[model samples]
Target: MTDHVDVLIVGAGLSGIGAAYRLQTMSKGKTYAILESRAAAGGTWDLFRYPGIRSDSDMYTLSFPFKPWTHANAIADGEDIRRYIHDTAHENKIDQHIRFGHRVTRASWSSDDAQWTVDASTDDGPVTITASFLYLCSGYYNYDQGYTPEFPGLEDFEGEVVHPQFWTDDVDYEGKEVVVIGSGATAVTLIPSMAGSTKHVTMLQRSPTYITALPQGDPIAGFLRKILPGGIAHRLTRIKNAAIAIGFYVFSQRFPQQASKFLIGRARKSLPADFDPKHLTPTYNPWDQRLCIVPNGDLFRTLRSGKASIVTDRIARFTKTGIDLESGEHLDADLVVTATGLQVVAFGQIAVEVDGRKIDSHETYVYKGMMFSGIPNFAWCVGYTNASWTLRADLTSQYVCRLINHMDARGYAFGMPDPAGASGDAAPLLNLQSGYVQRVAGILPQQGSSSPWTIRQNWFLDAWDNRRADLDEAMVWTRQREVARAG
Candidate 1:
């Protein structure tokens, strides 16, 4: 016997749970199931157990729109976020629909059947399931491994080396000298988090990234929650935070020089007087890559206290005791942490086939930043790179529900975006020049130069356009009989 459903959603993380909620509420009669690769929920929150694994984005916008984030802190810890996702699942009964330990390997679409046959690997064995539509909420990164660049003589290092993605309780750093490689969000986060217990901590970087400080808690959100209802307060806070994020991004893009100065100035004010300004400055303009955030200037405070330090230089090689810099500086360390970056993957790296033909994602153009061109009854959930992930994720879920409902009402068995409809030169799906994104640009999908096919990072525009989107625009709808007759 084969398991079947009206919808099969991949992942049980933030996006999957929200997708399930929207599907149940909006598309009432649809039967759905969530297939999670991991044994637990919370996806990224559950997978990454690093020391200072709190959200860089504020929780007000990062959290689901339907669920009010009652926590006082705007920047929430990883465990809190994991718990919140679990609580949401439990409250909505979404947990009952989740099949844990089932990692989807392949999805095959048949135009004749107007359904998808999905193959998944599980502890028990291989499992096959069929669904009318497939929604991939698996995120955009490889969960099994994080990206770490090959460093010369890495094997020669005598100290214990660890990657933030694979952090374990047994790997101790307390009272020991530690050096963290890369100056991304993970590095900044780990430096402050580990500085308290470590003898000394150093952040080693090839180049500097834009780093800034933000308050750990939102005072306005706390006030709103106290004075108004939970739902209203959540909505208002989400709007406020989202607006601020969008405004900042716009300002950064339009006035890169001023933005760079403002960010560097803030960092300069936070750091010690003798600290080299060159170490904090980057060659690229602001918004070229993502800016790292530290809650309440904790990282700066740690740096000022002499517990932690930053070194901006290329690696000469890894020594037995520490890494040798290109500038002939040597630092001793007991433990080395590679807080490098994540390996970006598309469609969870699951092989997708349509009517016995393998569909290459790179060749396909993105439709509304969610669906691929020439792909029927399928959607991928990816969040905004500039703002809290949940903001864009929520909009995507709602749009998926709307698309499903539209198909059902029109008696259409399947709907695919027409490749011909998308005009103009194609561009990379993601707009950021971040290392992680640039590394896998060849594998990711493409976006058109105009709306419906363009991926604009604006939340307000996406929300409004999604609400009023035309179901027929650049879409090819067909019924089962039509497919059969054509065949």
Candidate 2:
């Protein structure tokens, strides 16, 4: 049992850390604690240890606003990111308040007290802590499970089965055939990284996703980093990246067919003449699912080097040697890596309960994608999947600070959206077509079925609302002790 705190932020990933940084900087004398399930911080970065792992988004936009990114590599690697997070926390003195290895299992809200009762499992066992506000900085990515499709006769297979999420350093693919499944970012990253170590590598994807290539390091940023201050360079790069992201987001949303055609055209050029673009191309819409980024055409380079190749087919079953695709093709391998996809769980499978009743996440709409409808005294950070995640996270953090001030100024104990306002004609949030989004559909806060909550996935809206302006009407504020009445 622990005494109450002003704020309790779960997870230590980009979003979680961002919330802490903002809260500390914005709130005066506010007590906050960051509970990380892992032994150390660096949420996703710390958890994933696959080779060639790095940010898909540019560092300029990914880095925190207060802590400027000066790394020459426009897209930074995992270790570099972990270091940056650590440095940011330490420099800001946020490290002192974090509880490592404290995995939060359930958070229950007390309508009477207008506070949250958080039950967490630490190394010592379960302990309950109370807080006025619970900020779910836990990113949409699931922590407990990695994507591992049931390969038929997986037990019969003698080869090692692996997942990108739980990749370890010791898995030796030296001179062995490796098959990496799934075409998303994880598989794209795996093929290039394991090509050299393995005898030959095959990137097996059921269908193609939009894959655009960028260099490992930005030449322009590299030059500017040497001449200009790190902060200045960070600002320049962030803005430039944001502009590009904005253009794409708008283009895709406004002109779906046109944008898809343009993407197809680019794919044709980047890929080989023999490569089929139809199955490789998506059908629904662009920006509906996240795009994959490969550094310096890493997958292309691997293909060019004759060390790797891409196979598009449905994985029908698993045999002792490898996977059997529904197309009657079998991929023989000594090792198999399922980069299939992620499972987006609501609140990371960490339940949210109000009074004795468990909160129905699906019934709620997202207000600014940070706070939920009918969920009180709680704020969570969900970033742009279309762009750099940090861009949205940073904005969310700033928004929270404003919310705290709003609560303080007016004297409201708790704030959850008036369920009355959520009823009638409002639709379930999100327009994503990915399986992960579907798994947790209705549970996630509605962004309006459009963007910025119901629909805004662009980075510009995030920056404008978070760093550039005052808190908007979408947010609900609460006082220190008042609780929202849940129906």
**CA lDDT, every model vs. true structure:** 0.93, 0.78
Which 10 consecutive residues of model 2 have the lowest summed lDDT?
478-487
Query: Against the true structure, what is each candidate's TM-score?
Result: 0.98, 0.92
Mind giving the per-residue lDDT tens digits that candidate 1 earns over 26-111? 99989999999999999999999989899989999999999999998899999999999999999999999999999999999998
The number of the candidate with the highest TM-score is: 1
| Global fold similarity of model 2 (TM-score) | 0.92
State in Å the error of residue 414, model 2. 1.9
Candidate 1 has which clashing residue pairs, if any? Answer: none
Q: Where is model 2 more than 4 Å wrong at Cα? A: 226-228, 276-279, 421-428, 447-453, 466-487
Which residue runs of candidate 1 sit more than 4 Å off their true CA positions?
484-487
